[model samples]
Target: MTQQPHLFCFGLGYTALALARVLKQQGWRVTGTCRSTSNTEEARALGLEIVIFDPDHPVEGLAQRLAGVTHLLSSVPPGAAGDPVLQAHGATLAEAAPRLKWIGYLSTTGVYGDRQGGWVDEQSPLTPSGERGQRRLDAETAWLALPQPAHLFRLAGIYGPGRSVLDTIRAGKARRVLKPGQVFSRIHRDDIVQILLASFAHPNPGAAYNACDDDAADPAEVTAYACKLLNVAPPPEVPFAEAALSPMARSFYDDNKRVRNDRIKRELGVTLKYPDYRAGLTALLATESATSSSTTA
Candidate 1:
């Protein structure tokens, strides 16, 4: 029998958990890092060798834990302006490159900035508008410059089982915010895992891929669709100027670019399981409804 490659994920967030679970099922000896002891135990119970590491405190056993790890994936978001991982662990990764076969860094498509509702592909120039977006772009550059084979995956807004438009509607927080021609792209957690697995199987070094769905729908349309599905009234439409926005939400609204996913499909030979939000949100709502019914029955 063929042996599966050993894998280590630096952050076991929502999307990372899906990727780790899929790899574990494929016979890979998967290990991951978390911030707390509870998360470490939870990850171990799910069959991942867990390591507790917080870049803020800088643990001592990182190098030892990563020993003999063939594949390494990082989903850690960038810190304030100067990220410690890039300043400190950047050299550490370079030193471990000879033994590490593949590395992946999760980034955000916000790096492209607002395209005025225009389309952007892999070849488009990156001009991040916000501080967070700029930091992520910088981190991507740092990872790509490493001596080892590294790939950057710029992900769109991610939604999954417990996180979707239906949940927002049920929580009475779904809003139809109209930003003129503003449209946003998103990818499901399952599809993110699929793309990552495909990249691992094929092993492309020093490459960048956009992980997004096929559809780029307006935010208003998405909320309306969710309300229709749930047989509820959609929230009142709010004008972009009058909408109450948090710092993060305002920053997100700054970029209205539609990211293209052709490179991941053509190069990675990947097919998205939830190609669009409609299919993804529909399935999530169905599952939620079933669970609700079962609990009440």
Candidate 2:
């Protein structure tokens, strides 16, 4: 029998859960942290060793629990109150660096602000336009500066399973909002997991990778495509300037950059499970429709 590495994950969110699932299947002893009691129970139910760690209510023995961990993965968002793992446990992790083989930090491609529909790669400069993007950029720097082999994964918009363009359309949010020549990159959650696993298999210290698909489609085209897939009329078109937007929504429009995933392919030797949104959304819709039909039958 092969000896699996012990994996410790911080911020067990959607993407983190996907990674955990894959790691567990590969025979790793997967453990994760949760801020709330309910989340702790949920993690336990998924066969993960759960630890409660909230900056607000600091728990004892956190360092001890993390002592023997070999691989560490963090999906915590970056902000004043967001990244508790980095703010509170950076030193603990640094101290345990000898045993730690690989550290993965989930970041956003937003770090490369609007390239005016141009392409950006891992070599691109970090110039985030929005506050959230800036925060992510800062966190990436903090993690890399630590005394460990850190791998930064700048993820594009993530969608999979319960989350996809078709889901948004079914939920009455398939609006065709155009920002002139605006384009955005995306990746399926499954593909993100595959890339992360590949990176783990071939560890690269201080390496940065963009986790996006091959296509950088226009946002309007994606929404319209989802409507067509669902056999529903596409939502009326709304120009960017004419649309009423929240601060967060408007910030998304600020970065029309296309992220390149060639580094992950070349370095990690990863082939994307869903190279484009078309295949991803179609698979998700088929599963959803099948589930609905079974429920009614």
Candidate 3:
């Protein structure tokens, strides 16, 4: 009998869960860690095993459960003390994960930081302009240093169902905060999931790929497009200085760089379902409408 693939995710959040759904269709056994089991009823219904996990609070006997794992992926961000998974179990995974073939660390494009709205590829300099970017860069380095074929995916802004500009506009909170020459790159959630699966199909140890769409567009442009689709007026433009945004939200505008995703296409031989926000938003709207219709019926 042929052994089936088993994937263990360190943080089963949006991106990881999306990948898990795809892998499940291929007869893969999926298990992951989350902050709480209480919120995992939906995940459990999908045949996933979710364990309560927090960096500050380690789960006992997790090491014993990692046998026969064929792949590992982490969507957990690094905290003040560094990446929670690597810091806690890097050594053990390296030594004991006998079946492990590929390991992936989900990183951010912020590590290339504030390129004056210029373009950045995988070979771009690691000059992060913010703490979040810097921490991700450090985490990328540490994960690569492990005794394994650890790959890094530096992702752009992630947006998808229940989390896109559509949701913001529906809640009447969509604002086109103006920051001149500030362009941002983004990836749909499903695209990120596809990239994860593609990497598994073609493993290149110590490789770094920028995961984003074909276009690096302006925030206002995307909002206007979403509003157009919904037949609602786009929120009036607000200057960045005048906009009432939290520190963290404001910090997003701090970095301005267009990420290039040539590597994923070149190496992984993958094509993106949503090449830009226009395609992604249209699909999300359709998906929402379908779900709404099903629920009402």
Q: Report the Cα RMSD per candidate.
A: 1.9, 1.8, 1.3
Clashing pairs in 3: none
The per-residue C-alpha lDDT of model 1 at residue 273 equals 82
Choose the strongest candidate by lDDT: 3
Q: What is the lDDT of residue 250 in candidate 2?
A: 78
Kindly report which residue pairs in candidate 1 clash with one another: none
Q: Please give the CA lDDT of all the candidate structures.
A: 0.84, 0.85, 0.89
For 205-227, candidate 1 gives per-residue lDDT tens digits of 88889999999999899888889
In terms of TM-score, the best-performing candidate is 3
For each candidate in turn, the TM-score is 0.94, 0.94, 0.96
Better of 1 and 3 by lDDT: 3
lDDT of 2 at 123: 89
10 residues in a row with least lDDT, candidate 2:
53-62
The runs of at least 3 residues in candidate 3 whose Cα sits more than 4 Å from the true structure, single-residue gaps closed, are 97-99, 294-297
Global CA lDDT of candidate 1, please? 0.84
List residue ranges in candidate 1 displaced over 4 A. 1-4, 290-297
Give the Cα-based TM-score of candidate 3 against the true structure: 0.96
As for candidate 2, its clashing pairs are none
